[model samples]
Target: MCFLAESKINRIVFLSTVTDSFPKRHKGPSLTSPQRPTMRLASGHVAVQLHGEELTKIQKDFKGFGKGLVRLTPGGWLLPAPYTKFADKIYNTEFRASDVVIMTYPKCGTTWTQEVVWTMRNNPNFNHPKAGIPVKARSPFVDSDMLAHLGKDVLNSELLELVKDIVPHPDPDEGLALQLTANIPDPRTIKTHLPFSLMTPNLLDTAKVIYVARNPKDVVLSFHHHSRLMKSMSYVGSLDQYVDYFINDQLIYGPYWEHLREAWPRRDHPNMHFVFYEDMKADPMAELRKLNQFLGTDLTEEQLEKIAHYTSFEEMKRRDDFYREKEMQRLDQEVSKKDGGFFRKGEAGSWKGHLTDTQEAKINAWTKDNSQKLGITFRYSL
Candidate 1:
C-alpha cells in the first residue's frame, strides 16, 4: 500500500472521528423540508475549520482534475483530465447514431441518471422485468483501460487496471487508442466532469447533454467520504476541511458553482435539461416521465412500475451488485468506517445527519452565490 505522511494520517483519522458523531434526532422537516430562498448554504448552520497541508491537498487534486486534458486546449476551459495516454480513446471511439450524454459533477446522480436514462431509452416501463442490460458493459469510461491502451498513447504507465477484471466493457474491440475527436467526442452518452472551456469544441457542437445537480452540502458530504475510499484520495482531510477547498474552487472541477455554470448557459438550448437529485427523489415518477419524453421513447405501464420498484433504496441495497465491482467481494468483510465502495447510502437529505448546521449553511451560501453567478436557480432543500 502507498504510505501517506504521518500528519496526513492524523488528519484523516480526526475528520473521520468527527463525522462519525451521533446523528441529531430528526425533527420532521429539518431533513426534508425545503430551505427558504433566503436560507443559504452558509446560513450560520455549518462551520468548517481546516489547516495547513490538508487544505493544500484538495487544492492540488482539483487542479489536477481540471487540467487533465486542458493543457492542450486553447483557453484552459474544459480541463477535465482524462487518463493522459487514453485521452484519444475516449475522444475517438465509435458512437451510435442515437446516443445521449449524461454529464455531472461526480457523486451528483451520475449512476442514478444512467439507470434513469437506460430505462427511458431501452425500457420506458422501468418497472418491467428485464428492462435493460447490465450497465458497465454498455456504459464504458471513455478514457480508461477498459477501452484504450493508455500509456502507449500518452506515455504514462498503466494505472487503476487492478480493478479492470471487475468492471465490464461494451465493445470487445482492441481497446484502440485512436482519437476520433477530429469529428467529435465519440460514443452517444459520454460522462464528463470537464468545464466548458477545455472540452473539445466538437463535443458541445454535436451532442445533447443531461446535466445533474445536487446540493453542495450533500456533494461535499458524499464526495469527501468518497475520497476516503478512493485509494488515490486517501490522504485528504475531513468534510469540514474539504469544504474550505470546495469554496475556493479547489476541489475537483469545483467551485461547484463555476463547474456547474459551464453547463447552465447551454441548459436551455433545446438539447440540454438540468435535473436535480432532490427533485428526482421528491417526484421520481414525474421525473421518469419527463426523462422518457426527453429520450424520445415511451414505456409500457408494466415497465415503468418495474423500474420504480427496483431502483429504490431498499431494492438497491437488497441486490448484491448495484454499484459494486467484483473487487468489492473482498470488501464484503465487516464494513470499515470508509464503507469500502462507491455506492454507500444513496439516501437524500443525508447532510443533516453529518454536517453541523453551521457548516451546512456555509456551503449552502457558497452554493447560492455561485449558483446565481452561473445562472443555476435550482432549489437545494435539506
Candidate 2:
C-alpha cells in the first residue's frame, strides 16, 4: 500500500526466524468438541466460523483448535481454539522491569523489529553465540500456543533442546514458547500478536512495550501469503475471500482497527512506543535511532551503524536461516522454496502488485471508516 525508493534509503539490518512445530504429530482426535459452534461478533462477523475452505483447512490441519476458532467474550476477539485454555496463563504472565516486548498484529514487521531491538539491546557486538540462535529462542513469542498446536512432526530441535532442562508445566496445554518466555534470563526480549486488552493490565507499568503497526492493505496481502505458507494455516482461499475475512475481523487476532485503537490511546504512556511499518522501511536508521533513545541504551552512533548493517534486509535475507524457521518449510517445499521462505519481499506497498482496484478501494474505505476517529493515519504509499 506504500512504497519507498530502496536506493534512496539508508540500509539497516537485524535477524529473527520463528518456525514453531511440535516434536510429534497429534494422531488423536480433535481436542475440541466435534460439533462446530458459531457466535456473532460485535461487528456482525461470525466469531467461530468463516464458512469456507479457509476454515476447513484450519480445522483439518490444527486438530487442537476444536472449532478452529474461539471468541473472547466482552471484546469478541477471535483466536485459535487453544486460547480457550491458555488465555488465563498468558494474561497472568509475569513481566520484569527490564524486559522489552515487541507487540504487533501478524506479519506487521514483528520479526524484523524483534531482530532490530534484540540486536541493539542484547547483541550489539553481533558476535555473541546467542546471536546465532534463532530469534524464536532469543525472543519468545508468548502467544505461540497457536503455533505449538500445529503438532507437526518436524521439531525445532534448537528450541526443544533449549527448553529441555526446564521442568514441564503441570498443564499439558501450556505452550513451550510460553514456558521459555517465562524462564528466559532477565532483560528478556519477547514478542506477541495479542492486543493490549488481552494482556495483563499492568503490562505497560511493568515493562517497556513497542507496538508496530502496518497499513491494512499491505498487512492483508502479507498475511494471506503467510497463511498459505504456514502448514498450520493451509489457506487455499482466494485473495478476495481472505480480504473479506480480514476486514470482517473473522481472522484470528483480528479486528485490526480495534487492535491499533487499543494501543493508540496508550501511545503516550512512558513505557509504550509506537512504530509504523512504513516508517521502519522508509528509514530504518531513523527508526532505530528512536528505538535506541526510547530504550535509553545510549549506544554511540558507531554502534547504531553496525547494528543497522547487521539487520539490513539484504543481510537478513543472506542469513535467512537465522531469521526463518526452516524446519517448518520441509512440509511445503515448493511454496517456501519458490516464495523465498519467511523472509519475503519486506517491502511497503507491495500489495499494489496483487490487490485488485476494487479490493484496494474496499480496504481504503474500511480503513477510513475505522481509523478516522483514532487519529492514527497510515501511509498507503510511503
Candidate 3:
C-alpha cells in the first residue's frame, strides 16, 4: 500500500481547547459549535492570550484558526494552540547527520519539493516498487501529530482499515508521525512546518535542511484553498478576509516573512539549502541539478530528466487519486473536481486572479514592512 494513502488514515484530526476566562471581546465559534466558549491553547508555563480585536475582526463564518492561535513567547512564532501538546517532541527530537529535512510554511511548494527530494534520494530509477509509495509515507511530516490530536475515530473508513492493526503508542504525548520518522533508518527525509526556533537546536548542524520559500501573495491564495480542504480548518472566509489574516500574521504557521527570515540568514550554512518556489517553477531541471548537487545524489542526466517529469504538476495531477487523502475528497468533492484537486494549478503569480487591488496593496505593504531588512526579494510573476 502507498504510504501516502495509508498514512492519511490518521491525518484528519482537529479539536480546540476551552479557556476558563475569555475576554468577552474575542469569543468566536468553536471548532464544532457556534458561540461556544473561546478556545485557547495552554501547556506548561505558557498561556496564549486571545486578542479581542483580532478575533472580533474575523468574519463570523470563519471556523479554523479564528477559534484560537498561540504564540510561543520569546520567539513570537504563531501556531494553533494544540501545537503545545507536541512542542517538546518537535523541539527536542534527536536529528541524525544523515537526515534530509524539508522545512516550509504550509503550502509553499512543500509537496512539490518533497516529491523532488524523495525521488532523487530514494528512487531515481522510477522503477523501484518502493518509489510508487506516496511521498508522505517515504518522507514523513513530523508535525503531523499536531493535526491528529482529536483522536482516531474522526478518520474515514478507508483510513481506519489502514491503521487498524497499528499498536497504540505507549507514550500518549509521542506523535505517530514523529515515531514513524524516528524509525525510518538513515538518510530519512523529514518534513515540518515549524520554524527553526521550534525545532531541535542541533538540527542545523546535525542534518541537511532544505528551506523552500514562495511569494507571500501566492502562499496566501494556496493556503486559503488548503484551509478549506483540510476539514480541521473548515474555512469559509473570502479571499479578502483570508488576506487580512495573512497580513496580520494570524494564520497557523504564519508570520510568513518571519519563517523565511529565520532561514535566510543561514542560507550559506553547509547543511542549509535555500530555494525559491518561483525559481523552481521557471526552471525545474536547473533547480533539480542544483538540488542533486546539494544532496550529493549524483544522479545521471537521464535520471534527473525522468525525476523532473515524474514530479511535474501535470503528472502529479494525473495521479491525484493516489495523492489525496480520503478526508480531503469527502470534505469538498466539488473543490476536488473543480481544479486539479489537491494538485491545484501549480503556477506562480496566480494570486493576480483572486486578490483584489486593495488586498494586493495591503500585502505588498505588509511584505515590505516585514522583509525590508532581510535583503531578499521575491519574483511574484514568472
Could you list the CA RMSD of all candidates, in the order they appear? 14.0, 12.4, 7.8
- Which lDDT tens digits does candidate 3 get at residues 1-382? 1111212223322223322332222223223322332222222223343445555454253454443555544334556655655666566688988889999999888988988898898778876555655566667788876666533333233332333333244233456677667666566898999888778778999999999999999999998887776555667778787888777666777667768867999999999999999999999999999999999999999999999999999987676566465455335666556644577888999998788899999988878866787898999998
**Top candidate when judged by lDDT against the true structure:** 2
How many clashing pairs in candidate 2?
13
Error of 2 at 63 (Å): 9.8
Instruction: Write down the lDDT that model 1 would get.
Output: 0.49
Worst 10 residues of 3 by lDDT: 1-10
Ranking according to lDDT, highest score first: 2, 3, 1
**Clashes in each model (backbone N, CA, C under 3 Å)?**
36, 13, 0
Please, what are the lDDT tens digits per residue for candidate 1 over residues 1-382? 1111122232222111122111231111121212211110111111122224533454455322212221121111222233332333344444454667677876887777766676556545345343333443334334333222211232212222322333243222333212211122223355555454434445555566788988777788788766555433342456677766566554544445655756777777776778888888787778877876776667766666667777765565555354344444223233334364566777667777788877878877766666675665555563
List model 2 lDDT by residue over 135-201, tens digit each: 7778888888656665554334456766655525423345678788877786799999988877888
Candidate 2 worst ten-residue window by lDDT: 1-10
